[model samples]
Each structure stands twice: as C-alpha cells, then as structure tokens.
Target chain A: MTKMTIPLGPQHPALKEPVNFSLVLEGEQITGSTVNLGYNHRGIEKAAESRTYLQDIYLLERVCGICSHSHTTCYLTCVEEIAKAEVPERAKAIRTIVAELERIHSHLLWLGIAGYEMGFETLFMYSWRDREQVLDCLELVSGNRVHYAMNTIGGVRRDITPEQKTEILRRVSILEERTKYYIKLGTEEATVLARTQNVGLLPHDVAMNLGTIGPTGRASGIKCDVRKHEPYLLYGKLDFKEITHDTNDVFGRLVVRVLELVESYKIIRQVLNYLPDGPIAVKVPAKIGPGEATNRYEAPRGEDIHYVKANGTDKPERVKVRAPTMANYVAVPYMLNSGYLADAPMTIAAIDPCMSCTDRAMVYDTKKNKVRIYGWDDLRKLGIEHYKKRGVDFSKL
Target chain B: MSEFEKEEKLKAQLEDKFGGAISDMIIQRKDRVWFEIKAEQLVELMNFMKTGMGFNRVSTITGVDEGEKLGAFYHLTDENGIVTVRAKTPRTDPHLPTITGVFPGAEPYERELADMFGIKIDGLKPGRRYPLPDDFPTDQYPLRKDWKVGDAYPEEKTSPATEAK
Candidate 1:
C-alpha cells in the first residue's frame, strides 16, 4: 500500500475554473481531499462599498457570468425593499424570464462541461450547440448575453417586446425538444450512468447540514430551492416544479439538472405568456433611508444571498454576498471521501462548482465577436495559437 | 398561526430566554427578525436557535466593517422564517465566539469573514485563509473601510498619516 498526494487545478484541463484540490490517495481510492481556491478573487464585495447603489448593480452582476441576473436581482430586491419601493408587474415578469433563461443556458453549459470532463466529446458539442439558442434568446431580450444589467432598484431595466417574446418562445420550444433527447441520454446512457451512479455521495442529511442549495441540494433530497421555498418575483405566478432526486449521488445531480432544463423552459414560456404590461422601471431617489434587508434568490447553481444595509446614502452601508459555491463548499470534502481518484473530475463537475462566482474574471477578445460559440477544444486550439504567434511552440514546451 | 405572528412569538421567546445577552430586537420586516446580541454570547444564541428553536439551517454569516466597530450577522433559516443574530466587537480587535459547532455550513462564511474583515473567531477548525492569496499580507484586510484597493502597490500611500510620516 502506497500513499500519494496529487494536486488538481489553479490550472488543469479537467476543471474550467481556478480551484486547487490536494488529494491524498491510497491506491486508486481517495482517502482524504481538500480544496483550495482564491485564484479568481476580484474583491468585488470590497469594491461594492466604494460604488453607488446604481454602479454596484452592474459590479455585482459580473459576479458570475452564468448567474448574472441572480446577483443583480438579489441586490435590487434588497435595495428596493430598503427603500420600500414596489417593483412593477411587467418588470417582475421580465426579470423572471431572464432568470429562467439564464438557468437554461447555465445548465446546458454545465452539461457540456460535464460531458467534456467525461471524455464524451459528442455530448459536449451537442449541449453547447443547443446552449447557443438560449444565449441568443438572452441577447435578444437583454441586449447582452452575459451581463444582463436588467435589474434596477425599483424594477427591471428592459422590457420584452412582442417580437422578442415570439422569438424566445420559438427558440425555447426547440430547446425543450433538444432537452428531452438529452434527458434520455443522461438517464439511459451506460457511460454516464456507470461514471455517475452512486458516485460522490452526499446524503440528504449531510446536504441539509452543509446547507447545499438548488439542484445539488434537490439531488440529495434536501428540498431547499429558494424560488420554491421563498418565491420571489414572478416565480410565485410561474407554473413549474422544483426537480428533486433522492439518489444523493452524481447521477441524481445530472438528472436533476437535465430535468431543470425542461422546467426552466416551461418557466420561460409561462413568464412570456403572463408578461404583464407596465413600465419596466421607475426613478429611485438617491438616498435610501436607514433600513436593512436580506434578499435571497435561487441562482443557476443554488441559493444566492445579498444583504444590504442602507444608511440614507446613495452607497449601501454594508453589502454582503453569499454565492452558492460558498454554501456548498463544506460538503465537497464529504463528497470526495472514499471516491476514486480517476472519477475525481466528474465528481467535482457534478457539484457544478463555480469558482468565479465564489472568488471571481473573464477576458473578452472583441476581434472574435463573429464566433459567439466555442468549446474547450476550440479554446485549447486558441491557447496554442495565442502562444504560437509569439514564436513559441506550445506543444514542444 | 400567521407567519408574521410566529416570527414575533419566536422573537419574544428568544428575548425572554437570553435577556441578559440581548440588547435590542428589531423586527426588520415580515419573515425577518434581527437581534443585537453580546459578542460573547453569539455562539450560545446560535446554538440555542439551531437546537431549541429549530432554526436548523445556517443561511449566511455576514461581516460588516463599521468604522469604529465590526458587526457580524448570523442568518438562520427555518420553517418559521429567517432570524439574523448580530453581534458587534471593537474594530481594533474584532473577536467573537464561532458558531461552526452549531452550523458546520457556516465555516466557509466565517473563514471569509475572518480574512476579509480582520476578525478573530475563538474556534473554527484549521483557521486557514480562504478565498485569498496565500502570500496576501496579514495586516491589510481588504474589506475594511480604511484599506485602499492598491495599498499593496509601491506608491499607494493615501492616508494622511503616511504623508505626515
């Protein structure tokens, strides 16, 4: 019996984000594992204090590319409550539409990444290719794909036009069909089931104690979806079920996410149909009086919290953000326990860990705007090319 | 019982139970209650909330840097609603009891708070820095009001004391 320790990421092909895990292995079995992450820290919370309530909305929106609306909405909800402002009915509907669309795109992206990690290249391509449709719908609705910037203090920034609503429904219905096929593959595919079934187990009780939320919590049978439990915005009016799977394993999580894709599609349709007619936003005064509020929303990953204390200044007195990854961090070691080292990447991906959301950055090349869709393979090629242009052979190095 | 009444009743019960440690109890809003507790009694209140009062899940542990004092809020969630237990300590030496014993989920939030706000917890396992660079300076807590963003840079002396020196 030999003891060994291996480190995964800050930089690794297996993980998309910057997170380091030191694994202590006895043979193929992982005896102990600890995760270390800080590589993505942008000091956004600290930065928020220096910005006005208006600027903080955009700053907080960039917290996670996948769950941008969740951040802004949580911030807006808190600030709005503090000011005692009522969000217009139309604004709430639009917010819910964007949020559900973000969920759809996020889950599809996670599915592709999960497939890529599993060495199933075809599944990766199929999921991301479908993910583009959701991104397009988002762009059509909010004018930007990643940072929606649609949440204002009193209401939302944008309204859903008739043409936009028609286009969104058409695209989302197509997505629903594609999602059904993925659901079949996710549940019945031998490779996926073999790799995921009963692997990386975090039982229902453990999940509750660790306070895991969203799909991960539901997969473990801990019913803690903030939307279902709290029902903020138009989520109360929307007709959709919170998907739950009691397997408490990687397979269950995969099932839960795929099911959520279908559910999010339904929610988008519901919000679009019930898209109330009213002003999208109202002018909020600069100074919000002394008040405090805790706003929680169900992000694509899990529950996201934004606590705002306004002391009558334009800037929030104190704003604290608790992203889902922070809440789910404690249960990672428990999931990694007794798990195989080979299955490690899939196990980590099952949690759909978002290091950027927890710690945080991204770089956009304006030159490559034509190709809105790209995959890990394309990214790897781009990296090689990016270095090769500097007269360095990346492969040789 | 109505949701609002259940929350008020819960607040009354808590105030009655630990009247000595509590200073003020503010019903912040519907389904939300904020209590100002002594820094020394945060853990005791957290334990009582989780065990006795059935506030089983730890929602969040937020750290706020007030100029002269540091405020920490512990948000606990249950069927009733959310109860936020707050405690403040001096900014010079912010130290309080840790509630990881009651809510294991709060460990990460507490760690981040400890690192970001220069706060000290009496007990939280391992006590290593999280979501921060390993080589990050010990004296400079990023979230503090007085800490500038580029303070670590060579020529970033903004404070008047630095100019005076």
Candidate 2:
C-alpha cells in the first residue's frame, strides 16, 4: 500500500485549542505521526519577567483556562519560597479546595471530549452538564468560573465562608453521585469498551522514557504523581489514593480519569471539613531575592513545573513554565504509530492536551505533494461511522 | 529516611562520583537540590544521573540569559524530587551537548533552548522551529536580555491614503 499523509489541525473543531498533527497512513493504519505546536504561543514566560511578583499571579493564571489555579499556585510557591513567607493554614486549605474543584472540572470536561471523540454524544452531553456543578462551586467561592485568581504570593486571596462551605458540600455530594454513575457507565457500556479497549497502546517503558506525567502516565502504570511523590500545600495532609491502571491503552486512560473524579470529590470534602480559621495572606517585601526556586504541581492534566529567579527586584529575572501537555506530547507520535488512523483523535484527547498552556507550534509544507485535508467534522464523522460499522452505534442515544 | 537526609546522601554520592566537576551545590529544600557544572560535562553527568542514580525523568529544561553568559538548567527528576544541573557557556559561543540520548524527552526542551536563548545544542536533530513561528527571524532570540519586541518583524507599511493624509 502506498503511504498518504493527512493534516489534522491548526484550526479544527476537533481540537479545543489550535494544534496541528501530520499523520502518515498506510491504508487504514498510521505508519508515523508528527505533532506541530506554537499556534497559541503568547510568550507568557517572557511577559512574566516584566511584571512584579503580585502582578505575575494574574498573568500566569491565564496559562490554561482549565488549570489556571495550578499555574498560579505553582508560580507562587516558588515566589513565596524565595521571599520566605509563611502562608496560613486556612489559606492552604482554601487553595486545596479550589485545586480539587478545578481537577473535577477538568476531568469531567475530558470525559465529555472523550465521549464526543468516540461518537458517544450522550456521554459528552451528560458529563459536561454535570461539570457545571463544579464550575458553579468554583464561581461561588472565587467569584469566577475559570481563572479564579484565588491564589497570591503568600497564600490565597479569599477565605471560605461557613455558608459557602455548606453549599459546596451539598454540590459535591451531588457530583459524587453523578460521578459514581459515570464510573458504572464507563466500565459497563459496550460502546465505550469497544471504542476504547486495545486502542492507542502506550507501553510502560515508552511512557517513562518520554517523561509522560499525570493520569496519562498512571494509566500506563508509571505510578508517578507529584501530589503523592512530592506533596505540596495541603496534599500532604489530605487523604486520597493515587489511581493507576496497567492496561496502557485509551480504555485505561478513560478509567483513570473517571476514577480520579471520585478522588477529587473525596479531596474536596476533606479540605472543606478541615477548613481552618485564619488570615488568608501575608506581606512580603517588594524585592524578593537573589535566589531561585523550582516548583512542581500536580495539575488536573499532569505535573506542571515552574522556575522563578528573582534579582532583588519586584520583577523576576526569569520565569519558566512547563505545562503538563508539553511533557505528554513526546508520547503522541509513539502512540499514534501502528494504530488505526480512525483512533488518532481519541488518542490525542486521552492526554487532556492543553496547547495554550504549552504554547508551542510546528509547520509542515508539502506543497507539491498529494495530501488530504480532514476537517474536524469530517474526522469526527469518520470516527462515528467507523465505530458504527462495528455494531457500537451511539447515534440513537 | 527523611527527604532532607536522602537528598544529602545523593549529594554525597554525586560529589564522590564527579567531584571537581560539580560546584555551587545547594540543598534548596528537602525535595529540591541545585548544583552547577561546566557545559561540556552535562552529557556525562546526565548519563550517570539517569542510568546510575535512577533519575529517569527530565522534568524540564530552562535557559537563562546572565548578561555575559548563557545558562541552562536541566531539571532531572525521580520519585524523590528534582536535582537541577546548572551549566553556563559564553554568550558569544554558547553551546551545550544534548542529553536526548539519556532522556528522549529533553529533545523539545533543547530545541526550545536553541530558539529562545540561541544556545545551540551540539547534537539536536535538525527540525522545524518550535514554540515559534517559522518566519521568526533567525538572529532574534526572544528570551535574550537584549531582544526587543520590534526586532521580531519588520514595520508595517503605511497605506497610500494614509501617507497622503
């Protein structure tokens, strides 16, 4: 069979963000793949250098709409350490609450995208519908749904009021019930099982060599979570298990995420129950240090790392951000190889990729060559039709 | 053993293995450590850290502009924490050996180093520019201390109507 290459996206509906993937196909199977990024590179790292520590909190929060709190908290962890400020207990608990809620929101959003990619639009609709509960809970506490701006250099910006706590618990319990149903549905649904099982296999060794992190690595049985390995903030005190699955396929990723939703709820309950009473922030000098520090955070997607170097000024000398998506991207080509071309979108989505956070791009110009362009809708429809032929239709649902 | 002690033991082992080459060693905290070494020794140190010390993951690589010199920090990780290996090269002739053979994940980061700070990676496979537009000026390194926003692209042309006005 002759090899044909197709371009996936730089602007396609299949991707939540702008990223391009060039896949080389031999008949129905993908022989090779290359990911191109930089469509969303806003140079936030360079911008952070020009802003003061306090100002950079808001700047870094814009790194990812889904993991806003993760970036801020990670950046501030380095900033606060260099300044040597002690955050209060209540602030830590509040931050932990927001983080867990963000995790629930991000994971649920991924579940919806997974369902949509697999042509199970019903799961997409239901998970997104349930995701609003957590979004509302975040808005209630932090006054905004995304990019909460709840974190500051020393600690958090807001305290959790008792009334708000009660309401949050109420919502969390509701989400818990909904998530349990999802776990049952994800596990037992024949359509989901057929679409996901034995697809996009990432072996355990490949996952580690590529430095894959978060639930993606966990699904491959790497057993490396920043929260468990190097606990920060209230994670050390909170009780939750690091979920792992050794299946090392798209099904394992789906199972890990749905199960992680339950763990997020558990963490939310623990944080609210143990909410302490104290000031939410502390004062630090305008000039931070001639020192540097690196911080690692377990974002909803994976491990988010940040490095900050202060030059005895209000502004930082250097700021570096390593979004989780960037770490997991190296494994995309490896997983895409030897897999059916129809499974590419699901495999990419399984990483919960956030391109804006990674802010990288690539370009491939095959001008004088034969190539096919597949729009987002075309690829999605192709996936649905491909699965329908296998007797796993969700069209009626 | 405690995290702090574990880090200390690792530090001792590293010092024993590559004594004079490593310098400015500091235990930043319990779970983090920092040290500096020559840019030429990066590949050897990274190989030992990966195959010998079990620091199987390269968390991220950071490139910094320090006025007269260009510096890079390879944040290598294992279950314990991050052990940062810092190296510097002259800005006029900045070159660092790539550690992609030891940790394949470092490829993107090394490319990033080449693009942002103009620090050339000795053995990086030639590829398209990353996290930057293809038309981005070759001479302009955005993260360098002297780079300015206006340096990336040419000034926009004035319309004939505007010029007349």
Candidate 3:
C-alpha cells in the first residue's frame, strides 16, 4: 500500500487551538508524524519585558485560560524570591486553594474533551456540567472564574472569608461525589476502555527520556511531580498523594486525571481547614533585583517552569515561560507513530494540550506567497468536501 | 541529609569532577543552585550531571542578552532540586554545542534559543524555525537587546483609519 501524508491542523475540528500535525499514514496506521507549531504565538515573553512586575501578573495570567493561576504563581515565585519578600502563611494557603481549584476545573475540562474525542458525548456533557461547580467555587474565592488574578508578588491577593470557606466546602463535597462517579464511569465504561486501553502507548523510559511531565508522565509511572519533588506554596504541608498509573496508555492518562481530581479536592480541603489569619499580601520595592531566579510549578497539565531576570528596575530584564504542553509536545510524535489515525485526536488530547500557553512568539503569514484566497463560504465548502472524502458528509447540516 | 547539605555534596562532586571548568558556583537556596561554565565545557558537564550526579531532566533552557555576550542557562532538575548551568557565547559569533545527545528534550529549547537570540546550536538538525514564521526575516532576532518590532517588517506604517482621523 502506498503511504499518504495528511495535515491534521493549523485549524481542524479536533483541535481547540491552532497546531498542525503531518501524519504519514500507511492505510489506517500512522507510520510517521511531525508536529508544526507557532500558529498562535503571541510574543507574551517579549511583551513581558516592557511590563512592571505587578503589571506582568495580569499579563502572565492570560497565558492560559485554564492554568492562569499556575503561570502567575510560577512567575511571582521567581519575582518574590529575587525581591526577597516573605509571604504570609495565610496567603500561601489561599494561593494553594486557588491553585488546586484551578487544577480541579482544568482536569474536569480535560475529562470532557477526552470523552468528546472518544465519541462518548454523555461523559463529556456530564463532566463539563460538574466542572461548573469548581468554576463557581473559584469565583466565590477570587471574584473571577478563569484568570483568578489571585496571586500577588509577595503572596495572594484575596483571603477566603469564613462564609466563603463554608460554601467552598459544601461545593467541594458535591465535586468529590461527582469525581467519584467519574472514576467509576471512566474505568468501567466499555467504550472508554475499548478506545483508550492500548492506544497511545508511552512507556516509562520513553516518558522520562522525553522529559514529559504532569499527569501525562505520571500515567507512565515517571513519579515526578513538582509538588511532591519540590513542594512550593502550601503543598509541603498539604495531605495528598502523587497519583500514578503503570498502564502508560490513554486509559492510564484518563485514570490518572480522574484520580488527581480527588487529590485536588483533598488539597483544597486541607488548605481551607488550615487557613491562617494574616495579611494576604506584603509590599516589596518595585525594583526587584540584578539577580535571576527560576521557579517550577505543577500546573493541572504538568510542570510549568518560569525564569525571570531582573536588572535592578521595575521591569524585568528577561522572562522565559515553559508551559507544560511544550514539554509534553516532544512526546506527541513518538506516541502518534504506530497508532491508528482515528486515535490521533484522543492521544493528542491526552496531553491536555494548551497551544496558546505553549506558543510564545511570531505569527506565520498563511497568505504571504499564495495567490488564492478562500472566503468564508469557500472555506466552509472546502471543509465539507474534505470531510466527504473521509466518509463524513456535512452538506445537509 | 538535609536538602541544602545534599546540594552542597552535589556541588562538591561537580567541583571535584570538573574543577577549573566550572566557575561562579553558588547555592541559590535550599533547592536551587547556580553556576557558570564556558560554552566549550557544557556538553561534558551535562553528561556528567546526567549520568554521574543523576540530574535526569533538562527543565528548560533560557537565553539571555547580556550586551556584549549571549548567555544560555540550562536548568537541569532532579528529584532533589534544580542546578542551573550558565554558558556564555560571544555576541559577534554566538555558537554553543548541542546537548541534545544527552537530553533529547533540549532540541526544542535549542531551536528556541536559535530563534529568539540567534545563538546557533552547532549540531542542531536543520528543521523549520520554531515559534517563528517561515517568512520571518533571517537577520531579525526578537529577543536580542537591539531588536525592535519594526526590524521584522520595516515598511509598516500607521493604520489607514488612524491616518484618516
């Protein structure tokens, strides 16, 4: 059989953001694959050099809609260290609370996407519906759902009030119950098991060699979580286990995430229970340092690392962000090879990819040398016709 | 052993192995260490760290513009902490040997170093420029100290709507 090459996306129905995968297929099996990025590079790192430490908090929070708190917390950890500011215990607890809540919502969102990819729409709808509880809990604590903006250079920005704490616990119980149901559904569901069991196999050695991190690595039994290894914020004091699975497949990733949701709830409860009474934030000089610092954080997806260098000015000299997805991306081509083309989307989604977070610079001109311009209708027609060749007809719809 | 003492022991091991090659060594904190070494010694030092000292992961590579020189910091991590190895190359002729042989994950980062700071990796496999457009001007390095936004697209002018107003 002759091998064929197909481009998965700079834009595709499966991807939520822009990234392209060129898969060389021999019949239904993918023999080789290459990932092309940079469709969504916004140059946030370049823009960060022009912003002050305080201003960059909000800016960095926009790095990923899902892991906003992770970026800010990681960036501020470096900034605060360079400035040598001591954050209060209460602030640390609050920050950890928000971080874990962010984890809950992010993991639940991934579960929904995973379900959607495997043609399990019922799981997608139910998990996403349950995800709203955590989002609401985040809003109650931080005044916003997505970005949270709860972190400051020295510490967190807001304290969790008593009423808010009680309400959070109430919601936590509900989420815990829902997550328990998901754990059962995820492991026992025949469709999920059939689609994910032997798919996208990333072995233990390959995971560590490729520097894969977070749940993706955890699923492969790498046993490397920044929270457990280094323990920033209140994680050192929190009671939770670093969940891992030995299956090393998409099923392992799903189980790891579902189990991690339980751990997030546990951490959130501990943070709120041990909430200390003190000022939420402390003041530091605007001019931070002539020094450099690096911080690693365990975002919902994996390890998010940030490096900040200050030049004795209010603005930083350099800011480098390594979002978790970027670290996990190297493993994508490795996993995609020898897998069925139909399993590609699920395998990619298993990494919980956030392309905007991964991308940091430059925008490609899709129109530069090409003379043809496909208008909206033309593009729609093209999409329909393209899918028609693959046996999916959308003309009537 | 305590975290700081474990780091100190690792520091001693590194100094013993590659004495004169490493410099500016400092224990930044309990779980972090920093040191500077010549670009020439980077590959060997990284190998020793990975095989001998058990620094199994290259966390991320950071490129910095230091006026006269370009600096690349490889932040290597293990279960204990992070050891940052800073290597400097001349601004006029910036080149660093690739450590991808030791850490395959360093490929994207090395490409990023090339894309942002124009530091060439001596053995990087020729591939499409990363996180940058294919048509991006070859001479323009965005993260360099002297690069301006206009350098990439020099002919750009104010928007027509603003001009009309």
Candidate 1 lDDT score at position A394: 81
Once model 3 is optimally superposed onto the true structure by TM-score, how far is the C-alpha of residue B17 displaced, in angstroms?
1.5
CAPRI verdict (incorrect, acceptable, medium, high) for model 2: acceptable
Q: Comparing to the true complex, what docking class would candidate 1 get?
A: acceptable
Output the number of the DockQ-best candidate: 2
lDDT tens per residue, model 2, A288-379: 99889998999999999999999998899999999999989889999999999889889999998863222112334589555555543576
Off by over 4 Å in 3: A355-397, B1-3, B155-165
TM-score between candidate 1 chain A and the true chain A:
0.89
Off by over 4 Å in 1: A355-397, B1-3, B156-165
lDDT (Cα) of model 1: 0.83
- Name the lDDT value of residue B66 in candidate 2: 92
For model 2, how does the per-residue alpha-carbon lDDT over B1-165 read when each residue is reduced to its tens digit? 666888888889999988999999999888788999887788899989988889989999999999899999999889868889999999999999988988998888988999899988998888778888998888889999887565774362332222111
Q: Itemize residue pairs with steric clashes in candidate 2.
A: A37-A360, A37-A361, A37-A362, A38-A360, A38-A361
Tens-digit lDDT track for model 3 on B46-112? 9998889888899899999999999999999987588899999999999999999999988889998
Local accuracy of candidate 3 as per-residue lDDT tens digits, A28-70: 9999999887777888888788878888998899989889999
TM-score of each predicted structure versus truth: 0.90, 0.90, 0.90
Interface RMSD of 1: 5.2
